[model samples]
Target: MLEKHVCVLEGVMVSQDREDFFLLSNCGPKLLEQKGLALGGLGVASINIGLGGKTLVELERPAAYHTTPIFPLIRSDRKRRNKTTYWRRRSCVQDTRIVIAIEPSESDGDELDLPERCRVLKLANSVTYDRMEKSLNQLEKIVLPSSDDTPNDKFLPKLTPLVRVLMGMAQPSEKIPIQELKFFDDTLNASQKEAVRFALECPELPVYMVLQVNTYAHRSDTSTHNHNILERLLALPASQSGTKLKVTRVGHPARVMAHEGVLDATLEVKANRSDQAALAKDVKNELEATLDALSGKGKGAKGKAPRGAERRKMWEEVKALRKEYRQREGGVVRSVLSESQVVLATCHSSGGRQLRDHNFDVVIIDEATQALEAVCWIPIFKAQKLILAGDPMQLPPTILSIDKMKKAKNTGGTPEKSSTTSDKTGGR
Candidate 1:
């Protein structure tokens, strides 16, 4: 069954007096149809884009009154400035009863003619919403235009206009699953190890993290170092037969390379196990016998040598088997990510638009203090629970300009700085 979601319009409210009735006469029906809504159902005749001013007019035919009130769809002109320029050309529909004010992000300066019991919905980019919400006391709700309530596989692709429309209306879920938090310290003291052990003993999915470093080079190397610990944790239980754990690594080249090394080492260990050792011996013996027979040197061998045709066929079969084995091993490595219970990714890589549909049960961030707030939000948004490990006092985020700080202070805005320490520290 197709799910129905409640839609809400937010942002700057623009109204036109009786003199501007011509602005919305033509586009009202077309715009509503495009967004899969009925204009007449909402009693909307004309619409406008922009901010400021309020003038109401009675409609010829009002919508059928219902217990649940329906608000008008308010669209904003992308090119319109948020401040300074008043009397800007925008479109708005005329409605006499129930004035709907679309409070935009930049409507701080403009006075809104809000209804007595109007709800303020704050629309924001997924990463910026939390920071923006801290300062907004009037906000009754916060909406993420890039997110969806549907499951990851069933959700629409990100950045599509339809996705934006759907997300604007969908309600966000508040339930978060119980999970565990773990810290990975390369050189852990006894107390730290004991703490990790206690955390792991809990009845929940564990989140593992490492320490934060000042520079990207150090952080990348640390990720690699900690991955070794993760490997050991996986290997301890997997030593028993018929047990396996899948893990995915997302990070810089150094971290990935480190993970590959661990994979290779694990494969080697499996190859040398007792059961595999016996199989290897049997195969070696069979191959030796076959070679001896082909050369006419084995006991009770009748033929002088294998015919040229038979020898070629045997070689081809052997090559085919070897190729098949390599392909099977390669497939195991390639399929690890999709089947993995745990996924590891660098902050920048995690924030990629391509990963928008993915959801993690738990997220662990290492060296989080050095990470920009924006970069941190990408992973946080997708996880049910998050565990961050870092010493904020040791390595603060690097800021490039005092002018940006001044501007931020003057405008009461967040500092506009690069989200990664690597950029400021001159590391690729």
Candidate 2:
């Protein structure tokens, strides 16, 4: 806690329209890892209306956009998983303005102990932590470094059967008879076919990665890339498994995700009400500032914010609007999830606690290597069977803090094995 306050808090303050932003040097890895400030993070900030001194005025005044400096690497010629980053924003310390590109700590950090006039309220850095924590709470007593000889009889069957097998629970393997593909292209390579076959037959399976997958891959033609495996497998199960039992692919990344080539309709569900609410509040504050300026109040007037009747009224309206959005999200999610068998979402996008009781027959995670193991369990726990497809060599999950990673190893950060070690129990 003391270290966070020392590092994250001790930065020069820069004033944005609605809230304060702290600018740190590029050389600071800790600051770079946990980047940006949140609007809701602003709890109770007190500012002087007329504190525009020589240097103070400069920090508060708006500046044009600029590029952040690249952190010098130890060996620039060598290959690195991630290259140095630069964001388009203004900065004073020859670096960067904290942007939305990164996420902050797990909990709301300690207060930035600035003078009363300089203090700013910053909410928790990212909703990723909040949602991740929600998922973490549901998982109980999951073990990593699993061995085949470990006693499993004591483990309860709280998760889906396939997920249990994934946890090295020693479930019986079935020989599923193959059926013709209802939708997949018949010319799949031997490895692709066998991978698809194993996914169909087994409870838990880890296969090679599909292909280069990222935000840009979503734009390119799926035929060029091989991300459609999940989509192809979705339809294959209806006929291929011979049970004629309906198979629903839970997460699709690319048309057959690279959504329409083979699979059915796609429902994109993300939790964004909190973000929407934050925007509305900012608008309210801006409107108030505008009103004060128009009513003969000078530039200094904003500092003397009284939050009178008008302010309270605007807040009420924003609260009402936020509540309405929440209601709409619930009904829309419930309706879509109920009807659509094939649901597509990235790691933590599915409504976390909302999916508590619902379990699926199969849960397939495309680009399994891209997500940290802690995040994978959110969807894994909801599955009767689990299938992972990824190439760790192409893209492995990025670790921002080496210290946190080491601490996590001892403190249960990795609740499950990655695709590599997973083969020990999950098999080919």
Candidate 3:
């Protein structure tokens, strides 16, 4: 017998704006149903705002009316067989897979973090979600990468635990939420945690956590620089094994690490050296100052800080020491390293770490638009399924040509060609 059941993926991209959210939840199901798809919905939330303390918005998506919720879909154990339907937003009609590219109003920045799976198709007033889907249908003729890129080697060796006790610390009154801890815990399964714990405690093997922090603070000299981000990250609370963690700023000169003994640091080689040099020098100096401030807190130092200050200082230093080295050798190299049997870089400046020997199950990239197209291919080669998320409109490729925009705008201009004078002169 044929069966039709409705499954709702609840809390998917929950937006703070109740109005905009209601549109998203209802639009899809209503459209699907009108097309004869066997889907069902209760109603466009039936509640009204009143003078009382409670608001009508609180009554939406009532638990009693809600059916069993579907969790975010993860890649199944089976290998992905087709690229066309590799990541169908939802299954339907045999001809094409539907992808909804919601371009929320610019005012909705704080609404929620859009799910990583939703690709930012474009940024234009007329390029609504439906138009974007149509554009994708036309682009179906193009080729895309396969669903997964997981390599065979998945062995994580043991690590040594650090015996170094933290010098100073201040406890926050508020409890740290489980959600924050879950960020680290959810990455690995039970067996993986056992392996990670083993590796962190193994003194012989170096283990480090990598982080990229973005501070939206403004700077006077550099228009699009993130010196504050580097500064703030240098002050974050972090602790790890005794392995010497190091922080290297992106856009720094390739040879800077070589000079500092933090060799093999990844850097994206782009134009504009003046800016890169300034940013690099700023990052290096900030790191040195942070470390000195942290180390000086416990010991006797002139103009000593109070206990609270000392605790914050120590936390920053521990974090600096726990850094895992990062090389933005562009997207490709990062991708490749993510799935290497043993991670390695060209310069064994960090000892004889080999790239080909390391491997990873997943790879994620932010601010992806700044990277060259080639860099994206590297990780696709090594990762199981690469999650590339970024605002493409924020910053585009530096090498783009004017001709590329010819068809982008709806300008009514026609191309003018030079006419030959051979009509009268018969000149060749």
Candidate 4:
């Protein structure tokens, strides 16, 4: 059977929610029909997407709805404002009983509507398309039951005690087999080194490596971690085997250059800003020099009225130069990455898998603990022995911590209602 997954991307406006899910009911009245992968058949999982308003609630018919819940999908303050505006007067369906609660526009907004019992998984919000793709690829190996109680079959393995405790499997960690590398020190040991070397030797596939940087001086500096890691990896001693290593910074300026004729909106705009800044500085210098020269020439002149026209002309010339410079620098950088066989990737770009067709024989990951569980899996699916090297003690993955959630829910208010609800349900 094809592997299945019931991915819960918890953003307020996921891509899946944009489409009408009623389309699926065309084949069967049961939400969990022939194509559904619900386990044990007690309850079924369905794709739920919505914005702030009652319209989305009526449209999605979500399992539940709440006013106090914060949607991750809408990130911008302007968008959040728009959602509130649209939801305020939208008609609510009496039958739907869509509960809408208004709460503070902060992270605490998520607290009010916390599901008493549900697996609340979290993923990195701002990750690269490549890293996200990779994580999905690795997660593809672990089949998730669509419902809490799915019937056992070829697709649904009989739940073991350990599996039962896990509740539901997720990417990166779930996909990593028992024998794969474990959490270890910052530097690789003998076995880790040999495994990396062996995998890199595969002749037919591309060798991929990721260095996840945890320490960021600034938001932008976080992106530079991958580049630094790639540089260090390439500097490592070459193995006896004759496999060439290449590094590509996905979405980097050099990477864009390699792919001729394809223009990325993000990259194009980034290049323009850099060019414009340089052009502005150069023009300013030129204007200052022209002003100094003109002032020196007219230093002792009795009436500098004639010189005023010359100065005006010079100013116009400088202005023209500035305009010309802006135009010349507006184009995108043609090249983004180096020509090496090794690859360096960052958390942002590494969120999804960009390479395909089992191109990489061996995948190396650094700072695996800080990586998104889904993002970490992308490289694993393509490579044989995933060499995950990181310090788990430092930073954890971006996944939601149930411990933190429970603590927050109980700390501020009376936990009686939620606790009683959990007790009745026997805890999820």
Per-residue accuracy of model 4 over 265-326 as CA lDDT, tens digit each = 22322343443445444544554344334334233544232245765676566446544443
Candidate 1: residue 143 lDDT (0-100): 38
Give the worst 10-residue stretch by lDDT in candidate 4: 419-428
Stretches off by above 4 angstroms in model 1 are: 1-244, 251-260, 263-335, 353-356, 406-428
- lDDT of each prediction vs. the true structure? 0.38, 0.37, 0.27, 0.33
What local lDDT does model 1 show for residue 427?
Answer: 10
Candidate 4: clashing residue pairs, number: 44
Give one digit per residue, the lDDT tens place, for model 3 in 316-342. 543443221112112333443343232
Model 4, position 137, has a per-residue lDDT of 38
All candidates: TM-score: 0.34, 0.46, 0.23, 0.32
Q: Summarize candidate 2's per-residue lDDT along 1-428 as a digit string, tens digits.
A: 22332221112011111121233322243343345321111111221111000000011212222322112111111234433321111112212121211111110111111211111122222333334444444444343323543346332225545555655666656657667644256777777777787677664554446554354323322222333543444555445456532223332212233345433433321222233334334443453344343232437765453346755564454344434433544454454456555555555644343454466677777656555454566677667767887655543433333344465589977622221111111111
Better of 2 and 3 by lDDT: 2
Index of the highest-TM-score prediction? 2
- Cα lDDT of candidate 3 equals 0.27
Model 1 RMSD, rounded to 1 decimal? 27.3
